[model samples]
Target: MITRTQLVGAWSLESYTETDVQSGEVSYPMGRHPEGLILYTFDGYMSAQLGSGRRDRFKGQDPYGASSEEYTAAGRSYIAYSGPFYFDESNGRLEHEMFVSFFPNWQGQRQVRIAAIDDDRLHLGPDRPMPFNGRLKTASLIWKRALPNS
Candidate 1:
């Protein structure tokens, strides 16, 4: 079983894959090469920020003052959430009780993912397929422990 202490740290996104349940097709939601960070605090707080490998830059220099088109593109290429996390060793599950999320619908939702911890690598995915676009898809996210400097 993976202990909570072992999970406290920053993890870099290695890969994010989405599989179509019916057709068994695999796709990368964040492009072929994505970049992100998932951070777990000692106090049980956690946050995740994921982005597409390539994204269009905002026309304006100030990020906070971006134009509508810039904001639209940025929002569509990024994903982020933050909240408290809990581990159920007995069930081998990890629940991210989201306090805030890019999708407002998930703000008070608990995202429960199957936990698979292997040394410095952690693989998390949903037990069943969830609705995505117009089909049912399952996601598996691989993460590696971040170095101290990261």
Candidate 2:
């Protein structure tokens, strides 16, 4: 059985794909090689960030100077949130409490994910359907353990 201690570390995104519940179509919102990192701290805090394969730079390399269009483009390709998190050993699930988020709606929300680790990879499941380009889809996120710099 996996314990809370096993989850305390940095995990690198391996893949993120959304599958339609009805039609069974899979979509990669962040391309095949998107970048993301999820971290868990012993102090009971957690944070996650997932970015599209590549992002465009803001005008003059200054975000404050960017126009609304630039901001919209940037925001569309990123997913970020952070807060205290807890693990339920009996159920092997994680309750991710979002104190803040790039998507305003997630703030103050507690999201549950079925968690598993197989062959050194962490799989978060119970992929619930959500809006995806006008259709409902479930996201499947796969993560690998982050290794220290060699």
Candidate 3:
């Protein structure tokens, strides 16, 4: 079991990769360079925000006034969720219960993640196969502890 000291904090995204089950091929679902944050709090709450590196900006500054194409583009590249989390001490599995999600289907969803930390890196995933586009692939995400004020 990982100590709370090592697990609770703001972590910055380093890489997000998915490996295909049948072909054993690796891919980056959020473009080659993705950016994001995953936060674990002492109060058992967790939040995640992930985005592709290449996101297009809308022509209009007003979000509510954005065109359908702009709205769709943004939604396709970003994923966000927040909710309570339970980390099992005996099994070392982390369960994230999504109270809110940008993806409507994920609201009230519970996902079990395989989590591990070594040195300054935290590895998370294989939380069942993640569907990207139309294909399902096992995701492997790497995160590094966010330095203070960074």
> How do all models score by TM-score?
0.92, 0.93, 0.94
| Tens-digit per-residue lDDT, 11-107, candidate 3 | 9999998888778889887888999999999999999999998999999889899999999999988989999999887788789899999999999
Candidate 3 Cα outliers beyond 4 Å, as residue runs: none
Can you write out model 1's per-residue Cα lDDT over 47-107, one digit (the tens) per residue?
A: 9999899999987789799988889888888889999998877766789988999978889
Question: What lDDT is reached at residue 91 by model 2?
Answer: 76
Model 2, runs deviating above 4 Å: none
**Least accurate stretch of 10 residues (summed lDDT) in model 3?**
126-135
How many Å off is the CA of 57 in candidate 1? 1.0
Query: Per-residue lDDT tens digits of candidate 2, residues 1-150?
Result: 588988989999999989988899888898899899999999999999998989888877776888999999999899999999989788777889999999999999998887888867888754377787789888889999999757
Task: Specify the poorest-scoring 10-residue window by lDDT in model 1.
Answer: 86-95
Q: Report the alpha-carbon TM-score of model 1 versus the true structure.
A: 0.92
- After superposition, the stretches of candidate 1 with alpha carbons farther than 4 Å from their true spots are none
Which candidate achieves the best lDDT against the true structure?
3
Candidate 3, clashing residue pairs?
Answer: none
